[model samples]
Target: MTAKWREREKTGIRMGRRRRMDMILFNMVREELRGRVRRLKPDWNQLFDRANANKSDRWRCW
Candidate 1:
């Protein structure tokens, strides 16, 4: 599974997808930015915080 994931990443398969490809990357970038804006940042679980926050903030326009 690790090799497959690495291959997929190298092949750009995720990026080659339709709307979801962009959305996934956009969400990742947004999460990264949000984490950076805060002080006394999270230790190793920042992605968890971002994922949790992403789940609750689903907007109607989205």
Candidate 2:
């Protein structure tokens, strides 16, 4: 099987027609977010720290 199929199997992500379209839109938004982050050119370590902190807070809320 292809790598994409392998990844889907590992993640248990079964995408139907509607989900496929949603994924396409999600990817477009992700690309836009990446572009904006690249343009800012912030410190990588600082970004990592912030992300980690946010993730911790998110888990706490759960």
Candidate 3:
């Protein structure tokens, strides 16, 4: 492969990997938040309550 084309190919591969990683993390977060939605206390505000919780989502809510 020519040096310039090799560099472009590497860049494309890196970008594709990063995008896939981002999509996976985003989906995991979405499903976790869905669990929270089902069990959230009525008195708490969504943003504040999620932020102030002492445990991680997996531990406490999700």
Candidate 4:
């Protein structure tokens, strides 16, 4: 392979690995938060509460 093609392949591999790591970390954190909300007191879990259907319908609350 040409030097330029080899360099591009190396970069692509590195980027793929980084993307996978980011997705893994994101899923781990999301699961952790879900677990914490389930175990915590109701007051502490207000953000995750679904009491207000109207708030959820919007694209962005903030």
Candidate 5:
């Protein structure tokens, strides 16, 4: 009923909205990163295999 109480209520509503927006944005970014990692998993595995193979070849040469 008072001015101070109204201002506090408004601020609380704004904070809640901002929190929801942050959560949505975070989820969007997380999903994007997950998709990217999924797409790159095969490439990452291939590179890992190649590195191991190259290391073995180097040891053989030594």
Candidate 6:
């Protein structure tokens, strides 16, 4: 094979490896975010519920 053909082949291999790494990293980040959201969702709901409860109490007082 010519030198240019060899170079192109090496470049293609490197790009394929990079794409696979990117996908792995992306999935890791996505799972981490999903876990965080799962943990935080209940806290978020509790906060919202408290805020609404307080608002209703104030309306009753007034």
User: Against the unseen true structure, what C-alpha lDDT does each candidate score?
Assistant: 0.54, 0.49, 0.52, 0.50, 0.52, 0.52
For candidate 1, report its TM-score.
0.33
* Best of the two (1, 3) by lDDT: 1
For residues 1-62, what per-residue lDDT tens digits would candidate 5 score against the true structure?
57775676567557685465456546755666676775754344554454356363222211
Q: What is the lDDT of candidate 5?
A: 0.52
Per-residue C-alpha lDDT of model 6 across residues 1-62, encoded as one tens digit per residue: 57775676567557685465456546755666676775754354554454456463222211
* Clash pairs (backbone) in predicted model 6: none
RMSD vs true structure, all candidates: 9.1, 9.8, 12.3, 13.6, 21.2, 22.1
Give lDDT for model 3.
0.52
Compose the digit string of candidate 3's lDDT tens values, residues 1-62.
57776666567557685465456556756766776776654333564465445543222212
Query: Largest lDDT belongs to which candidate?
Result: 1
Task: Please list the residue runs of candidate 1 whose C-alpha ends up more than 4 Å from where it truly belongs after superposition.
Answer: 1-16, 38-62
In candidate 6, stretches whose alpha carbon ends up further than 4 angstroms from where it belongs are: 1-15, 38-62
lDDT of 1 by residue, 1-62 (tens): 37765565555645554355458757876777687776555343666565456563222113
How does residue 10 of candidate 3 score in lDDT?
A: 63
Error of 5 at 13 (Å): 5.9
Model 4 lDDT per residue over 1-62, tens place: 57775666567557685465456546755666777776654343453343333443221211
Which residues of candidate 5, in runs, are more than 4 Å off?
A: 1-15, 38-62
Better of 2 and 3 by TM-score: 3
Off by over 4 Å in 2: 1-15, 38-62
Residue pairs with backbone atoms closer than 3 Å in model 2 (clashes): none
